[model samples]
Target: VSVCAEAFNPDDDDEEDTEPRVVYPKSDDQRARLQEACKDILLFKNLDQEQLYQILDAMFERKVEPTEHVIDQDDDGDNFYVIERGTYDIYVNKDGKPLLVGKYDNHGSFGELALMYNTPRAATIVATTEGALWGLDRGTFRRIIVKNNAKKRRTFETFIESVPLLKSLELSERMKIADVIGERSYQDNELIISQGDQADCFFIVESGEVKIMIKSKTQADQQEKTEVEIARCTKGQYFGELALVTNKPRAASAYAVGDVKCLVMDIQAFERLLGPCMDIMKRNIVNYEEQLVSLFGTSLDLENPGI
Candidate 1:
């Protein structure tokens, strides 16, 4: 199955509410260890506390003796395994010989590729030392992970639609943006962007407000510059596009006004997905400059673009 967001249709209903999830009760000691191990794994990072508990409950432990073959190459895979204890060697059959390619010690995960792609196991896993492994069935994994991912994509799609800067973009382009964008949260008074920093990722306010500040010279004789608030961006409003477009250092700073949440798009995604709309974005700068002139009574120097 394709892992891309678009590959999983949003219309497909999540079975989470209806399906009876399998549970393997664990002792408090076991739960603590699993929680610590899961925290370091990238696969579980996106899941919330409740979803994480569901995963922990679904996992069953398997004890293995030293030199035992845990999984054989080319065998049909049904469950994904995470190491709880001991070491294991990964061998891929190259020609007729078993080639030692990788190893997992103490904490790691495997057997996911087979379940994810619905293919035969690519390698053989042999226990190098006596250990235990946590196993999760494919059904539960897909129901929780795959379905939740689809839900997230749908949420992002809906939110991205409200961003005025992206209104002119085609539907396909907007969907691509939704796939690449990520979320970031900031506390009140937290600095989001610093003046003179190189342009990297731009942002759209998802909640609360962001204050755009610029350093301006009040007079030719002034020894120090004064930071003035230029704009306040609320939900659906975007900033930092100008510097990204001009390939210049940020000419202004931005800070969270209250508890704030933002959707972030890095420079790479901006260049790749929004590249075709460069002319449209450039034209929009005129309106931006006009707004600045009206609001601040002075315009920003385009040679050093601001957010």
Candidate 2:
């Protein structure tokens, strides 16, 4: 019997141990950390715990390598990524050299513009170290941020509160404006409005600040130059109101002071909702008239009601 048992054992010493070994599935702690960290990100902020868990389940254990290019300038931006670990550098081509624009570390994010419109990548981003990143494609990201229940409306309202131009609007009018507005967020120094460009939309600041620069003609040989800032916009301030009323070129350029969030409404939408309402028009006219009367009294041209 001993001889037969020995013959059955391929390796005698190895077979001597009969205890079973415990095996554990990979820990979900990393995923939990990521979900918790991303809670404040633009697309994930409004999601509840249960909704966040669902998102975590769909996005676990994803990883990226050091020096990997997360995005390239001019590429079609179709994905948004959140860094769970490590760092990344944003670069732009200047004079045939890659100029470093900024660095993003843990909890940093990029690629949001893809969710709003199909715009080209504004800068190239490369992972500076081995990192874990969570990715949401354009379609999925939009479904969460723009298509989810009441999220878009709430975000638009939040944005409207930041612009000064919209400050005079009543709640009912604000809601009407919110229905047609779009929200956007940009990093520090990003250009929100370019001078001389045809203005298609008006913007309301939601968070952060912006600097305005105007183009002017100098007396020195009639040379055109940019004028110093005539206005600085902060939260609850609005710009480009004139653009919504008239399809004219932008009078000034607006650049992000830090990170900025804005609510933008196209001229067509503005005209459709707020322009035709005689009551609203009359109310605005009266408000403006009252201000003028306070400043200039009866000498002001009060006959033109639309001003």
**Model 1 poorest 10 in a row by lDDT:** 1-10
For model 2, residues 95-175, the per-residue Cα lDDT tens digits are: 888999667766556775534444577678898888888766554444444344244556567666554555667876675
- The CA-based lDDT of model 1 is what? 0.77
What TM-score would every model get versus the actual structure? Answer: 0.52, 0.43
lDDT of 1 by residue, 13-36 (tens): 842366698999889999988777
Clashing residue pairs found in predicted model 1: none
Clashing pairs in 2: 162-236, 163-236, 163-237, 163-238, 164-236, 164-237, 164-238
Q: In angstroms, how far off is 155's CA in candidate 1?
A: 1.6
Error of 2 at 105 (Å): 2.0
Q: At residue 131, give the lDDT of candidate 2.
A: 83
Q: Give candidate 2 misplaced runs (Cα > 4 Å).
A: 1-27, 149-162, 165-307
Per-model lDDT:
0.77, 0.60
For candidate 2, the per-residue lDDT at 226 reads 37
